[model samples]
Target chain A: MLKILVIGATSLIAQETIRHFAADGAEFFLVGLSADKLKMIQDDLLVRGAKQVSTYELDLTRLDKHQELVDTAMETLGVIDAVLVAHGTLTDQKAAEQNVDITLRELNINFLSAVSLLTILANIFEEQKRGVIAVISSVAGDRGRGSNYVYGTAMGAKSIFLQGLRNRLAKSNVTVLTVKPGFVDTPMTAHLKKNPLYSDPRRVGKAIYDAMKSERDILYVPFFWMFIMMIIRNIPERIFKKLSL
Target chain B: MKRYESWTRQPKVNHQTIVPLHWRDELPDLSQFDKLVLPFGLGRSYGDSCLNEHGILLDVTGLNQFIAFDEETGILRCEGGVSIEEILKMIVPRGWFVPVTAGTKYVSVGGAIANDVHGKNHHTAGTFGCHIPQFELWRSDRGRVICSPTENKELYEATIGGLGLTGVILWADIQLKRIPTPFIDMECIKFRTIDEFFDLSEDSHERYHYTVSWVDCLAQEPQLGRGLFTRGNFYDPPLGAKKEPRALPMIPMPIDLPSYAVNPLTVKLFNELYYNKQLRKKIGGVIHYNPFFYPLDAINDWYKVYGKAGFLQYQFVIPYKETREPIKEIFRRIAKSGQGSPLVVFKTFGDIKSPGMLSFPRPGVTLALDFAFRGEKTLKLLDELDRIVFENGGALYPAKDARMSGASFRASYPRWEEFADYMDPKFSSSFWRRVTSS
Candidate 1:
């Protein structure tokens, strides 16, 4: 059976990820920050008939413990077939702009943590020469905008890092999936205004799962975001810098 | 290099972002690239399905040329890059038209086939892919080869709605459907509810040669899905005015609409007036084929209405059996969400199996809605809609979907593995990169 580890299992996308893999009879190790959240997910996976469900209380920002967590999860679940790095913090741009600590935390959780986990998982997957790593990035990474450039910068870094990782891992048969979602409905975005371009976590999860299975390089969850971002990214610098996009 | 005197849009793809790559038009002797994106006439495709990103995007319009035509047989052979506008310019004067035309004639033969684009006639004639007898595809791995229904069938199916992932289409021999004339006899019927719209749409199939409906998204409850149902057929002379002269006059949106111009208040007002104006019990009329087929082509850069932040067009198809319910639900959700951006449309699809295993279509009803770039809440609502679509066993259209999850994609297109197996190893794109890399 496939062994999968869904980091940030408490997130909406991660919840869908757990359901998808668990439903397929794959063994899953759902890791997150809150024990209660992880247990709830474990119960859902069990009810969905997962091969085996395990929960790990994880704080991805504790970069030092990332490898140990992977090692422990591997020890508990046997060889890892896929690793989904879905954990991220949607740091408030206004708050971060005012507080250095908030900005640092956003970077650490959104970019640095994924980088650390990917580095470790890349090595492990390289050793195995066969495993998939799915990273949930946002279309916000396509370009920096006044609205959410801080978060965009973090995702952009993650996207670029994953691109490099993908290039390096090409020969190793290790698939690195970068999911650039346009907009997804999640608790993180509940307070925001309704978006016509928004996508659901399940849709994001499906796109990620499909990308992993197909070994796609980068996927615009929902797909239209590719054009939307392409247009946004290509806006001449003279014009783009002036807009509030 | 061949150049026509027509006042053509220098770079025809819909994405104003594309800077045409100049190359020698001497064909049969092209560059050796790992992969090339064929950007046909109007890059109308909502996604990069037509873009190669960092790879070479072969601007096929340069190869635009009419190779052969059999007026009697209605069989036409043309260069892959020939645009429908180019065809209409020549053939419409000679009394002929495309068997099927998407919302715009700006698309090239290659883009049309690559997208397997359907139009009002989809319920009758099927997609452009279905009419193609065969096409020449240049694959990085396999080299140049001819593919058709009976020859290299897999490659043929893969190329259509394959999102150009299969290879570059060189030229094609397509069987065109002949019409009595270049003009159309039209009729407009307005409906109040989703149920009435579907009923009329289904009933119109037996009585009309062409049919399409424009739904007003801002309308709520009783007025939901209210739209002008237009059905028409080709007619001669006095029956219909000679098709509108191709006035090469460019009508660009004078200025970018104010950022907040398309919010709920304005859209509601616009929808109310638009609905009332089309509230006529019956409006029988005769119209030119150009206005009937490519209405939006008259207004260039129309997307600028959403201001610099281009809008997103979400088109989804639900099976015929579950059409009314989901559409009602989808409209209700949109109305309740207060993310009002209009130009919502609903059309009944006829019987035609999707060309590609993962192509988006079934015996069903399809709805398309346009939304301006709003922040997070818009995404959340779309996510909720995605769940509704999933639960109904409907699939989102890949050509227009940009926010679908990998899991949802897998579930929607179960035969994705089959399409994946044919993906050119060297064929990598930013879109592909985004999906594959994490």
Candidate 2:
């Protein structure tokens, strides 16, 4: 019996991940931005066989509310076994490139806000000495391509921070896993044309759920993205930057 | 705001807009508008039954919610927008299954009821509407009302196969079938002709809970309707272990293929290989219901295989007495046309009365053929088949119908006026307009 907390519970991928847990009667605490969507998911999770489900509507970027959201989750779902951090938006590449304001906001939502919550959970898990903290990092973080360099930069920073967190928490038995998904078909990416490489959010969510069960530190969803990113990462800066990816 | 097509992707029309609605939220008041409004679910109805041409389509896929479930009795309740896939994923592990399901699990409950869809197991269980005990409907003329077999009976009968013209279905209470395991004990047998198929079905229907066959429409005369007949029954695993619901990986077809990709020659060749690929004449295996029921769902965007032009699926059921001669005639006409569908299905239907007034299934053997849109040539051929089906006193299923004429419609469903009496003035669809007009 796992007691889990899902932040950004209404996101397509996160909702799918919660379904796996709900099927097995896991207790849940969900936090998302939309009140209507949160209620819908709470009801859905209950029907899917979750033993208990509690939801809170909060804007993730509201720094002052972070502590309140976490405290409520911890109190509602006592002895949390795992925390799935699956909130983040694909930044508008053009908007970020032209405006610093847009770039800063994107960084706050994708990296800073998540780091704020993780910092709070890391300490809680550290004191408890048992818990898994899984965060979603994009494959765009592996190596920045010109097409989406700003989004890549924010994701890259988040991945680097999680790497340090995982290393530091190793001795305390608090496992931190970084998940890198590539081209998931979701409302976030609906504007872009889909290709053969695009994977369903449910499939990606399934992979992420499976990865957390094991003791893996870094997981590339769909698995092949690891090799694809490895090749992209190894490319020379001169040739890579010259051509559009 | 943009133009859209039916599931078939043919005759793209400019729609007012597609608003993917969440049923929990207050529905927008469309009474102010002059355009006819219709509820659109997963858009899986291969024909115009799901389309509101040049008008507003209230996209209802987002209303999916599981409202209630009684574990002991296997009775379930959910929003009409909930898909069969979502229900199976939740209940199958609990040893409960949908009483009836379509070829694809993506169809919404509203669509299933609207079409009165039937699956291979229809020989025993009947249409999807049969298991539905009650449903709530929202109409412009009549705000909201609950209908069922025993209560509000006329509306219930009309709304089931009313093709969404009656109103928007809010939620439904369904009685689910209990099963020992999620595994299906399946067997596939080869048959050379429609007569052999009839003989085989007569025997299989009593032993197995579900039965369906696939005919190679391209095969001529001596081998006219050669096919693989498949039958299955829910089986309990040997030990105490229950099978976990397995979600198959869906690899997408990235783009619309070239028209030549699925032309006559290729279909014939593929059918030849497919028939022979079943090396053993008869084979038995224990399998999950996912692959057993939904073979096409294994590939995401499989409809794209029909290419940009899209394809039409013509499924009509003729009574048992008229099965053989008409089936052979239809097969010969298809083979001679040099147009073929790689996947052509023939199945036995039991003597079950449809819960919907316009329901398609009756006591019969039915054949469904998919034909690529070849413009006039295709229309002419379907008209010929339509005439045959009409003459035999059989009806065309509105779910898979796009081009059924008013005369054929009248011949098939004499009770259309009975269904029309309860029709919501604010609701209408492209199919309804086409079938009942000049």
Candidate 3:
């Protein structure tokens, strides 16, 4: 049975991905912000056929506890075959633009906290010589936009960090996958107006699971997001900077 | 905000507020919203029952999460928003299946319970609510109430087929049936008359676990009720056989066809071809469960075939009398109206009683047909059919009805007033309002 550690265990996408592995009797060590939600996910995973599931409650923004989180997971699961870092907040661009505290908090949760965990997991996986490290980034990371530059910047930074990690861990056989999902109909986007563009979380979850199992380095969930992002990236900077996106 | 449509895509109504909830523990404070709120599932109720018009829709699709499942007991506890498709994906590989399923796998468990959905095997398993041992109903006033047959019995029975007027079902514990494999041993036979169909139905009930028929609504005289009868049992694949994949992606219907794409002439031709597709007198084989139970689910948004104007499914059940004469009269009226529906499902509901107080199925003959909305013409035809059904002591399925009159509803479901007593004051739907006060 494969042992997996999921950092955002209660996240809709993370829970969905974990379910795919659960049917195979994979063991899980879950880390999340809410104890109640994590407990629910643990029970969910157990019923779905997980061999074992353990949860740890923590405010992930406290970078000081990153190492302890990994240590606990290593102790509980013994050998982690995969780690999915999927917890993050949807930054309110309006609030972020007006308040430095809001902007900083978004950065702390979306970028720095993830980097803290990845730094520890990367070293452990490099030393162990095998494992999958999957992170959920956003298509907004492809290019910063006026609508959400704060969130875009954080996701861009996380994507770049994962890219470097993938380069460093390649020779060690540690697969680092950066999943860039487009507009997903998750709780994070629940307040936004939904359209045909928003993909279902289940679809995104299945894509993550498939990409992790196949050991792919980068994935544009729904695949169409790849072309959509490419178009945005190629837009001339002069024209891109003028039009509100 | 997204404008939501029910499966039938008819009677489009704008819900003032749409709240898509993700976590059960984080249920919003109901008192904050002034308007009545109806929990919306997969929105597959075919009509206005799933719509709230100008009120609030607490979209529950985001609450799709499983709580527990026991391999030995075949009992699954999951959030109400979990779809039958998701359940099948999880349990089929584990050698278990839903105790009862509708014609479509897209429906959420809560919607299924609220409507008390029935399936091909309803003769044996009864309605979906029959197998629901218990569920958690979160009322705006009462907070969370655990409803079961033995506890809160009145509310439990009322919530089933209560048309989303009771409260939002938080989660449910369903009893699943064990299956050796996700395949069915199916037998198909052809029938030429209503009496032959009735005879075949009577015989199949004793021999088959699942049974249904396709009737040619356009047929006349000698071939008045010509159609195909199909029956099946869960196939126990021989040991060492290759196991089928857990789930197959449904082929999507990306766009709606033109409004005139499904006219009577086209329907007649389609029905003719479908009836003659099986050349042999009788055919037997092993078929996958997906097509056996949910043929339309094979194509995502199959209803789009009826085009942008949308369609309405008219399904009703009349008690089986000593004669098969009433069905012929109903079929003749349909044929004469020239509003032929290509997909007409004819089946017999057995003696199995549903726990739902307003459940549509009984020991009777049930007929379901789809008609593309043609404004007044279509409504007039259906109104005529309603009078005939009411006269025959039949009732319309509220889940599939968009315009059933209040008198007809009251006449059919005599317990409406009793059921109304259990409904949450803050919970209501367009269907409820239309049927209760029209």
**Top TM-score: which candidate number?**
3
Colliding pairs, model 3: none
| Reference-based TM-score of each model | 0.57, 0.78, 0.95
Candidate 1 structure quality by residue, lDDT tens digits, B1-438: 112111121112332222232111233332454344344345567754544544555455544445556768777766676678767765665566787787878888887887678888778877777788888876657767788888988888887777666766667887776666666777878788888887788788987878888777767888877777888788644555544533322211112233355888887776776666644666766666777777778767667677755667788888757446776888899888878565665788888775665566667888877787686877788898889888898888766765677777778878777877876554544444444443
Better of 1 and 2 by lDDT: 2
Better of 1 and 3 by TM-score: 3
Report the TM-score measured on chain A for model 3: 0.99
Which docking band does candidate 3 fall into? medium
Assess the local accuracy of residue B383 in candidate 2 as a C-alpha lDDT between 0 and 100. 85
List lDDT for all candidates, in order: 0.72, 0.83, 0.87
- Each candidate's DockQ: 0.01, 0.25, 0.53
Please write out the lDDT profile of model 3 over residues B191-270, one tens digit for every residue.
98888888898889977999988888989888888888889898865688666533333211112233356898877777
Candidate 1, B-chain TM: 0.86
**CAPRI band of model 1?**
incorrect
Interface RMSD of 3: 2.4
Best by lDDT: 3
Instruction: State in Å the error of residue B159, model 2.
Output: 2.5
Tens-place lDDT digits, model 1, residues A11-33: 77776665667657789988888
lDDT of 2 by residue, B92-176 (tens): 8888999999888988999889888899898789999999999998787777789998889999999988898888888898899
- Please write out the lDDT profile of model 2 over residues A128-195, one tens digit for every residue: 98889988889999998888878898899999999999998998998898999888867687567667
